[model samples]
Each structure stands twice: as C-alpha cells, then as structure tokens.
Target chain A: MNFTNNTYLAEQLKIGNTKAYDYLMHTFYQKLCAYAYTLSHNHDTAEDIVQNVFVNIWVKKKKINPLFPIKNFLYKLVYNEFINQYRKNKPVEYLEKKYFEAVDTSVDNTTKNIEKLIKIVNKEIESLPPKCKQIFLLSKKEGLTHTEIAEYLDVSTKTIEGHITRAFKILKDKLDTEGKAIFFLLFNLDVFSEIKKL
Target chain B: MKQVEIEKIIVKYINQEANHKELEELSGWLKKNENISIFNHFVNVEYLTAHNMGNYNINKAKAAIDVKLKANKRKQRRYQIKRFSVAASILILFGFVTLKYLNFNTANQPKELSKKNNPKNKAILTLGDGREINLEKDKNYSSKNVVGNSKKLLYTQDNKTKTNLSYNYLTIPRGGNLFVQLADGSKVWLNSESKLKYPDKFIKGKPRQIELIYGEAYLEVSPSTKHNGDVFKVISKSQEITVLGTHFNIKAYIEDKKIETTLVEGNVNVKKGNSEVLLKPNQQSITITNSNSIKVLEVDASQEIAWIKGVFSFNEESLENMMKTLARWYDVEFIFETPKSKKYLFTGVLEKTNSITDFLEFIKATSENEISFELKEKTVIIK
Candidate 1:
C-alpha cells in the first residue's frame, strides 16, 4: 500500500500521540539508520543522523504546510541531516589527498608485494648519493636532455652526456647483474624486464 | 600537444637547460593545468614506483567523519527536542485542536494508491505455449493463446476443437513468466524464468504430467473427472507437487534451495525424492535440500495467492528477496554491492502496472536499500 494518504501520522504528532510517534519512529528509525550507515558505515553515526532528522521533523510539525507531501518532507529531512553529518564529520585535508588511497588498503597480498617492490625502488632512488642521484634523477627521474643539463649546470654539453652515459651504464649493470638476481629472488622476474620497464 | 613535443620539453625541463622563455611557458602551463601535470609526472617517475600506490581510502575518512557526526547528531537531536517543546507549546495555543484533528484523520485514513505501486512482491507468469504474457497487464483480453490473470496467466491450446495441434512448451526466462491451464480446466500461473512442459491434448488413460524445469508456478488444478487416476503432478529439480484438484502455489525458483508449495484450497501431497508432506488449506510445505526434509507453515492463502489478484504481498521480506520478485515481473537482473543490504526487508503490496523506474523509487523511499536500475535493450540491471 502507498500510504500516501496516511494523515494519522501528522495528527498523532500534533496531539503528541506517544504511540503514533513511536510507530513512526519504529517504522522509519531503522530505515534512517540504514541510510546513515550506508553513507558513513558507522552505526552510531547513522543512528544519530536518523534521530536528529526525526526530532527536527517533529519540532517543525506546526510549520509543515497542510498541502505538503509528508513522505517527501520526511525524505528531505533525512537527506539534509545526512549531508550535515557528512560535512561535519569530514576533514578538509581529506579533500586534497587523492581519492584512491583507501583502495590500496583493500588489495590482496599478491598485489601488495608488487606494490612493495615499487615503493622500495622509489625509496632507493630517493636515498642515492647526492651527485650521482642528481645526474640520474635529472636523466631518468626528471627526464632532462644532456644539452639541457649542460646549459642548466653551466658545463660542456659533452660533459653532461658523459655523466648520463656513465649513470646509465652503472644503473644498467646494477640492475642487470646483482639487482636482477635480488629482484628474481623476490619477484621471479628477469632483471632485464625491470630495466626495460624503467 | 604532440607526444614528441611533450617528451622533448620534459627532457629539457628536467635537465634545467631550457631557456628562460621556454622554462617560463612550461612552468606556467603546468601550474595552470592538472591533466598536463599528471601526464608529465607519470612519465618522469619509474613505472613500478608510479603504479604501486593504491587508490585513496574514502571509506576510512568517511568512518572517521561518521564518528564525529554521530556525536553532533546526538547533541542536535537533544537540543531540537527541547526547542520543539517550546515551539509546540506556542502553536498549541493557536491551532492545537485543528492540528491534532488533521493529524489524527490523516493517520487513520487508508492510503489511496495506484496498482503496481510496489514491485517487490509482484510475480511474472509465462504461458506454456511458447508465448510470454505479463499477468500484470490491464484487464483486457482479446482471445490470444495466452490468458493474463491479474497476477498470473493461463495458456491452453484449443486443439481438441482444431484436432491438429502438437505439443506446446512454454519457457520462462530468469525473471520470466509462465501461465498454463490443465486439462480439467484448472489454471496455474508461473513465476519468472520458469518453464512448463505440457501437451496440447490429454489422452484419456494417460496421467496429466507437467515438468517444471525451473522457477515458480501457482496451481489451481481442476478436480479429476471420472476417477481414471485424475492425478496432476508438477516435477521440479528435487520435488514433485502432486495435486488431484486443489488451489495451491508452488515456488521453485532455481536460486532457492527449497520447493515451497502453499495450498490455498484442497490438499497437496508434496513428494520430495524420499520424503513427502501432506498440506491442508492455508498450509505450506517446503522441501529443503536433497535430503527430503519438509517444513510446513500455516499462512494466509490470500497473501500467498494475492499475485493472482494482481497484488504482491510481502511479510518482512529481505531486500535481496524483493529484488528476486521484481526481477521476475520486470524480467531484470539484480546485484547488491553491500552485504548489509540483505538484512533489509519490506512489508508492502505493489500494483503490477507501475513502471519499473517508479516502483524502484518508491521502494528506495520505504526500504533500506537504494536502487540504481539500467534498462538495456532487452535486459534490466538493478544495482
């Protein structure tokens, strides 16, 4: 049944019918809780959200227009309460961070392993010696041309080229020989695959 | 920008050798744009390093926020209640009596609702002659092979008069329909995605046998005449509904593990492999698993057969269960993203004629679930 014409709820609320209020509360409280939980995934918050919406509705019964659809009004109350809860609970810093961080936590163990390896490599690069790392970082990480590095470093273009070639050879040898073996021991992939991917 | 242009600029920019003019333009553009920065950064970082980070955890953040909101709501509700008492006192002095009367009248009044207002409890019946019929369609019938009941339909061949008809089989799709008429003129309406295998003609000495491949069907089996066995049997996967002449509804959906036979009138002896249950009027027999244990419950026949009258009646049915009901009538698929949604059930009746969209919106309002429906050319997806 639609219950569209159920005005008994309004009448009971007006006269402070405890039973009517209880009935309405019982009928909708769970639903309100569920809606709140879906958005927040917290039981206490959901309960509070529903409870506040109902209290507001009851307080404003006198001002509720005679022609207003009660169901629509009730829904609007719940929605507004949910939004208010969301805004109050949320931190502004969360909005600035990327949205995908939460998803990373839910990944399975196998996926996490690959992720860990990636993190290790990044950390290693960050921890490299200052001069060597700067050259490597500019060539590989920052993606600078030898000519640009020479111009920026105020060195001869040939000297910049020599630095990158030397850096590449060292990086390639480490990864291809000792690095490849270590990576194989952990991840089972060839060192060449890692170097080529890089 | 071209890929080569981007790559060259990135190299130049990274080397810190770009001229002042070039550096100014690149920095300005990168600062002004997000997409460019992402692409540039993505290429510059090591592949493994860039790809490893998982998506941001919105759920955790939401949970934290929810905790704070809960405390706020508790405070707000308490304050609002106190404020309401004061405002209510003032309003009572002005229009207390009128407001109370209106509220009383409104609550007491029976809600006027269009049929098909709720879709969860509706049943779809496909006829046995390879013709699909929506039982929820309006009350007009033009002598088609399929007969549409308010909640179920009946289909039988007039081959006795025509004398040249062959075997006719009706197939119900998952979330499909099946409606059929027995030789003795008893009517049966099938639920979604159910199939009924029956013959056009009944030989005098042969038994009236119909195999229910899948889904549910309500039987109003006619009384056998002349006592030549006069037995009517419905064969499903693990259960068989044997009724001589009775009004009962048997729901044997594929997903359900039990075959439920709710008898409205007369008696139905449900034979499940090795076990059987004798059911009386208002009694329901459920054959569970392959072990043959049957559970019978006393229920209102009207509630069981309400679909025959074009109304779906549910008693504390879960949202997952409700989705099955809607799936059959509208011929759609349902998927629940969260497990908690299973705990929500709705107790209501929905008219069968309402648009699926309208029905979902109404349920979303009253039930504990949110519905997002996508109707493809031939498939309806409910999430």
Candidate 2:
C-alpha cells in the first residue's frame, strides 16, 4: 500500500520495501535534521544524529506502533539517539551532572505537589524500623500490593501485612501527636493515588 | 479483623476482584482509621508499579516499556537483523573520518577525494587581495599554478624558473566546507571559517608554505619521490607548524584564540614563536593564552576531526562553546536568554547537515532545558 508523508513512509518501511525506505529518508531527512540540529546546534553532528535515527527507524520498523504518529516516533527516536551517543564516550558521573542539573530546574509544577507529599511520607516512613520502612516504601512509594510485596520479599503475606500495619501505625500516631496529622497522612495518600492515575 | 484477612482484601482490591459490598466495606474501614486510610492510599495509587510514580522519566520508561510491549505484540527475531544493520551503519559513519584519514595515508587515494568526501574536508584558496575561492568548485578552471588531478588538486608554477607564483589568500568560512588539490597531488579539506594563504603554485627548491589565519583544516598530503624534505608549513596566529608527508588537521580559529594542531598520522613539529613541540599520531598540540608556549596532549583523532567528515565532535564542550560551533555552521547569531546558560556543557556527536531545531531537540531530550527560538531577520534568539 502507498503511504503519505511520515505515516505512509513509516508503514512502507515496515514491510521491507527498499523503495519505501528511500522515500521515507528523503521526506524525513530535513525534518530529522531540524530536530537533530536543535539538540547539538552543530550541523555535522546534527546530520549524524538524524542519520542514526533514520537507520534505527528502518531497523525497528516492525516494533514501531502502527497507530503511533511517525513524526512523534521520529522525534523520540532522535532524542534517544543523542542520549545514547552522549553516553558512549562521556563519563557517567559527568553526564549525570548535566542530567541532574537539567532536571532540577524544570520539574513540572504538577509533579512538584506530588513530590512534596512523597517527601513528607518518606520522612515519616523513615521513622519506621528498617524492614518496616522498606516494606512501606515498596508498598506506598513503589505501589506493590501485599501479596506482591510478600512474593518480592519472600515472606508470608501475613508478615508483609505486619510491616505495612506497623509502618502505618507509626506514621498515624506520630502525625496524630502533632495534631491534625491525619490531614498530612491523607495528603500523602492522595499524592500516591494521583500518581497511580497517571 | 486479622491482618491476613485485610491483606487478602487489599490484594483482591488491587486486582479489581473485590465485589461491590467488599469495596464499600473497605472504603468504610479506611475512613475510620487514619493508618488504614494511608495504607489504602498506597493501594489506590498502585504502588507496586511505582517505577513510574513520577520519580523517573515517563517518556523514557515508556519507550522501554514499549520494547517489552513489542515482545508480546510481535516476533522478536524478525527485526533483529534490521536493528543490527542500522547500528552497523552508524558505526561506519562514526568511524568515517578516521577511516578516510587512515585510508588516505595507506590506500590509493581516491581519484577525486571531493567526490568521496564532502567539500567540508577540502580547503579554500584565498587571494592576497582578500577574495576567497573555494578550490573544490574551481575544478574545471585551469590556472597558471593550480590544477586538479584524479583526486589531487595541485598548485605549481608553470615554470620552475619562476621564484614566486601569484600570491592568494584562502579562508574556509565558519560552517563552510572546501577542498584543495596541492601541486603534488595532495588533497586538503578545510573546516569552517578557516583562512589559508599560499602560493598559487609551488616552485622547485622553495619550501612549501601556507598561512592559517583562522579556523580548522585537514590535509591528506601525497607522498613524493623527490622527498626533497618537501615540507608543509602552516603559519597560525600563535605558532608556525611544520610537517612532512602525512595526514593531519590544523585548527586555528580566530574566535578560539588558540592554535590547535592535531596529528592523525606521521609526525609534526609545532613552533610556538620560539618554542618547539613535536606531535605524533593521535596527539594534539595547543598554543594558548598568548603565552607563546605549546602543550601537547594525546587524544582520539575522531574527536578532533569529526568536523572534516561533516559532523560535530564534542569532548564535554560547554553549551556556549557548542553554540559558537553551531552559530558558525548554521550561519546564525545566538542570544542566550538566561545568565550563565551558555556555560552548560555536554558530550555528544551530531552531523553538520541538519537544521537548527534538530540539534536542539536532541540535546533537550538529555537535559531539562526549555527552549523556544525567536528568529529576527537572520539571527536566532534561544529562549
């Protein structure tokens, strides 16, 4: 079947038609170049980045989502390619420094609220015994249910329940002693629930 | 009331297996006890899969998850070869410059290096009067001194009797690519914004000399039988570099304020004013700070010469430095929106043919930089 721009081109690539691959390359060459240039700001590197992305798309055509827009997929692929290229020759620690710096300032406002709640929960969770704290984190922060927690911890579900109960009780009493601590507890819980929805 | 019963119900609820009454009863109990309410919140939040609880990157994890999803959606072996091929192509391209440099040194040089390599690797010829001519495009023109061979472009006087050929200055523009065939069939590729001044043709018994005013250039010098100590000299702002028949690159960008000469193969001696420093393959000599002293460092030739292959090379280059390179190639002006924004540096490789937006998106993926560009006339303001 004939395809249009990115969609048809991506589809044509999937079926092993070499001609379709060429068509896709010519069409997306400039678009990919634009995206790559946006990242490195160097024409030479930008060209390399786009070339890699196109090759990757051709190779991973079958894995690509048919319904997923080709342009979006290309954008994502170009981004991932740059990250991969950066990591290969760069020291991990040095690379992480930029990563953390880039992340620290741009946290989404919506995520910030959840993060604040998680911070509070973590502080209270830390008050628990080490095992209990771990259990609580795996359950509350990691979203593991009692049975899954038992399976992961290799303990009985009853024991897993003990950890959660103890962890919950400690947080409850500490917050209650602080007066209206229940609200804090609820807020933290709400944050977790909100995260699950996402 | 036992913990086992509560645990059972929680698991059932998490699995969405709880009946209506069970759900109501569970909600009622959570409302009554603060601790149970917190515990229930965790269940509601699906904490078991919290790998994506907004703690990590959703898009990245989603991509990974997509890989897992694809395993279930289709056969894996079918795409394996294709993936491998794509990876292979990149490795080949990534190694293209190094391979070309090495091949140019050992293998028979291509009849037309310009056809095999982009003009970015070739050098430009500058007139003494300040007019720059791209030597690659002038292949068809026959001058008194310069001529193009199968792959080599040469500049030589029509008569050995002539001591001086017409003096011309050649500058490779920043982000601009060019090629030149020397008198002895050697080929040189000039990187962005570099200027070179040399004789239109070389006369016998005269040492071959070329001046590098600014920017980077790569040369694939052809070997000769006379070997009359046929020396090639590159005079830069800070130092004078001398080399025999070999493959190497000289970068003396004006804005960089430093002259860098990298040897990919063979040997060269860099003279920083009065001081002399020798360089070997994969070695870089730098004369910096106007001190007129040179420092030699061992380095990867690919990192230094990727530009000649039409790609960018970064060794943890700062954002400001990266932008300067970008500005030259894209021929745009950069205005940083935030203070100290330009100081950011990252290690990455990008090709030199993509548009401005492509590079930005590639870097934006690695870091959290909100970038929006405003174009006025021809300048780009990054916000």
Candidate 3:
C-alpha cells in the first residue's frame, strides 16, 4: 500500500501483488504513453508499445531489481520497444540508407549515453570564467530575463548578453569536441537566441 | 555553415518550421551518417520536451491493458499449476484470504443507486447566434472552424480575415466537465457547474481575451510569442489575469466570495481594479469580492489543478467546502444534519471517476464515523 517507497513497491510486485501493479499503471501509464506517442506518432501504436512494456515487466517481476528506479526502467523499456518496432516496420531501403550501427541501442547503454552527455555539459559549464558562468546560470538555470540578470549583476544589459553568448560559445565548442554532435543535442541553446532577439 | 546557423536550422526542422531552403540544407547536412544520428537525437529531445500529452481516455486505455494482463495471468497460472501444484494451491489459499480481508475492510461500501448521479462529459455550447448544442460523450459536432467530439471542443486556427469577434459560451452543467482548445491553441479545462466565454477566433496582434463567467477552470495558455506577441487575458468578476504564456487555475464560483488564481508554470499578473500583483510559479493570489485586497500564498499548484487530471486533491479542506465541490460535480445537494459535521476536515486524494458512494465511504472510514452520509435521490444528508 505504501507506494511512495520504490523498494517496497518492487518487493510487492515480486510477491505478486495486483494492487501494486495497479498503482504503477495508474501512476505512470499516461506519462509513458505520452513518451511512446512521441516516438510512434500513432495512438494505437503508442498504447500497444506501453502495454507490451508493462506486461513484460510483470512477467519478469522476479528479475526486477529493487535498487533501480522504476520510472527510468519503464522509460528505457518503452524506448527499446519503440526502436524494435521502428526497425521492423521501416522500409528496407530506408533502413539500408541510414546507418544505426554506430549508435548504442542497448537499454543500459542508451540511458548511460544520455547521462554521460549531460555530465560532460555540466563539467564544461562549471569550468567557465566566473562572470560568464554567473550570467549563464542566471539566464538559463534561474530563467531570469536579461534585464533582471543585468540588474542583479549591476552591469549593462549588453554586458550580460555578451557574457551569456561567450559562455554558450565556449560550452558548445568544448562539448562538440568532447561528445561530438550529441552534446549540443542535449544542451539547450535557446537562451542564446532569446538574448540575441533582445 | 556556421555551427550556430546549422543549429538554428536543425531547431526549425525539428519544430516543423523549416522552409524548403532550410529543409534542403538540413537534408544535405544530414547526408553524413554522423549528422543523421545528431538530427535523430535532436528530434527525439525536442519532441520529448515540447509535446504535451493531449486528451487521451485513461480509463479506456487502462481497461485495454486490464484485459491483456488478465489473459497473461491466466496463461502464467496454468504453467505454474502444472509445475508446482502444492505451491500453486498455497498461493490460491493465500489469495482467498487476502480477498476476504479486502472485502471485510470495505464491508459497508454503498451500492451505486443510480447511474445518472455519476459525473460525465456533458455540457451546453451556446454559439454566437444563441443556438445551444448539447455536447456529450459519443456525440460529434463540427463547423467551419470548430470541432466537438466526445468531451472536447476544439477551435481551429484559421479565418485570420475576420474583423469583428464572434463569441461562444460553453456552460458545463452540474455533474459534468469539459475541455476546450481555443483558436490560438490555448487549452482550458472547465470543472462542473462552470461557464467560459471565448471568441470564435483570436485576432492576430491583439490580446486574446476570454471570460470565466463562473465556476473553476484550469488553463494552459499558448505562449504569446507564438501569436505575434499578443498576450492572453482571462477575466472574472473579481479580477483579470494577464499572461504571456502559463498554466494557471482559476476558481470563481458564484456562491464563493473569494476568487483564487493559482499559477502552475510561467508567470501571470492578477489585476483587481488598479492594484496588480505578479505571481510566480507555485504562487496563488486570492481576490476577495468585498475588498480590493489580493493575498498571495505559496501552494502545491499540481493539487490545485488536479481536476484536469481526473483527481480531487484536498489539503485540510473543510467538510462543508469539500461537500460543495462534490455536490457540484455529482449534481447532488448536500444537507448537513448537524452544523458541527460541516467543520470536519479532510485531506486526501480521490478519483473523480469514482461514484459518490465511494467518496462517502472514504470520508466515513477516515473520519472514524465522526461523519456519515445518507443518500436519497440527488440529496446527500450528512450527519
């Protein structure tokens, strides 16, 4: 009954508690479906993908690791299932033309890949010059307007913009060299354009 | 191409805003295998962030999975029984005991008296010509610029040539709820016994205005940046809410003296007469009808907008106030047998799709028989 504790819920699932399964479905069904729909685009296909994921989780409950966060596990399963279906339904010519061999599509590897890219970006941001880092954090992390950040820093708005732009340029260049194209894909560069418009 | 220029093109392409030239450039860049991987990852991240889960029938989806799960269980049960007969018998016995315990705990669960008492997707849409259309589940209605299916009414973003605004009113009756998508893609979820007045099409370069005539509504306003920097405004009797783009809930029931506006995401300005206050995320502004004062408080914004997610979440709300909300949604009247029972406090989350009896059972059980309910027709007499 105590769903707040993931370990307890995992134990209950392993012991064959229908209520625990029901609670999981109620909590995460829609969100996972939304994630799947983003990949599949079709309503029925998304529902089917999510349903299959849930069924597999229950069927393999004995192997469920209590240490793993169930939410991330469910998402990984849904992503892998979507990829499986995509490869099956895609035209052979399209599959041949696009190379997916370079990508690590394994469940654990894909999640780790995304996490690694984020870690690299964070490290790069941490190494920025003090003023540039402060302005960048204010504009992006705190979601402050240019004027607000300038007021806080006691500087002209143009200076604030310059610092943010410089920070983005440095991070982008560093991340591009380190993680290749995947790093910028993870980093949000929209703040740069917002500053430019202002 | 410069890195920033290519990034901009990729962003536009993922957003489906890329022109032919941009598309050609993107395709040319994507010709490289590594660039193709980057484009795919970019699309995945963009879609994952931008896409809101549109109105999907959760109950229907749950039922579909329920059928599949039951079949899977049966198949597994057959295999388990064949492999370990003694263990399977023990499990069956344990399941029987657990079922008995559950039944005993819910012993006094009331039978649903009538299906009419259940809250449903029913509303009255009054067009500009004063014609009323009944919108309900399984019913469909469509016009040149509008479409109504099931519980949602969607206005297409077209007809930019129109000069004068033609307003429409959506009145949700007691025991009913509705979802409306405005012409500018802003979404509004109306609770039971609520009415919203909005124009058929929001003009470009003009602030989009709508009125929550009465009752409660949760809105996810489309960002003003998308519509030529035109802001969205929601007006009620007590106050006006101005938004650039935000998710907020407004409760302005006719019977209640206080009008509450809770900001969930982004920023909103609450203006009452000349006084205005800007609200941050998780902040709520309460405008009293008798006074011009606006009081701001931090609240769990998710709980305030739980109705849109088919939940009734209350935090130490008085029994009287909670009953009022239940009465509106169930289309039933509550008569307290003793005034003391009205002050009983409740803090819990209940599913909106559950019958009134289930709710009463929950309150009764939690309150330790401090309060009880007697159902007769559409009246719930609380004792």
The per-prediction CA RMSD against the true structure, in angstroms, equals: 21.6, 20.1, 23.4
Ranking by DockQ: 1, 3, 2
Candidate no. 2 TM-score: 0.46
Quote each prediction's TM-score. Answer: 0.40, 0.46, 0.49
Better of 2 and 3 by lDDT: 3
Among all windows of ten consecutive residues in candidate 3 chain B, which has the lowest summed lDDT? Answer: B92-101
Name the weakest run of 10 consecutive residues (lDDT summed) in model 2 chain B.
B95-104
The superposed Cα distance between candidate 2 and the true structure at residue B221, in angstroms, equals: 2.6
Question: What's the lDDT for candidate 2?
Answer: 0.58
lDDT of each prediction vs. the true structure? 0.54, 0.58, 0.73
Interface RMSD of 2: 17.1
lDDT of candidate 3 over B184-277, digit per residue (tens): 9999999999999999998887889999999999999999989889999999996999999999999999999889999999999999987899
Instruction: Please give the distance, in angstroms, between residue A138's alpha carbon in candidate 3 and its true position after superposition.
Output: 62
Provide i-RMS per model in Å. Answer: 16.7, 17.1, 10.3
> Residue-wise lDDT of candidate 3 within A75-169, one digit each (tens)?
88987787654443334443223323212222233343544645665676778899888876665445467778889979997676567656655
- Please report how far candidate 3 places residue A175 from its true position, in Å: 66
Model 1 residue B84 lDDT?
A: 26
TM-score pick, better of 1 and 2: 2
Off by over 4 Å in 1: A1-198, B1-166, B174-178, B225-229, B367-383
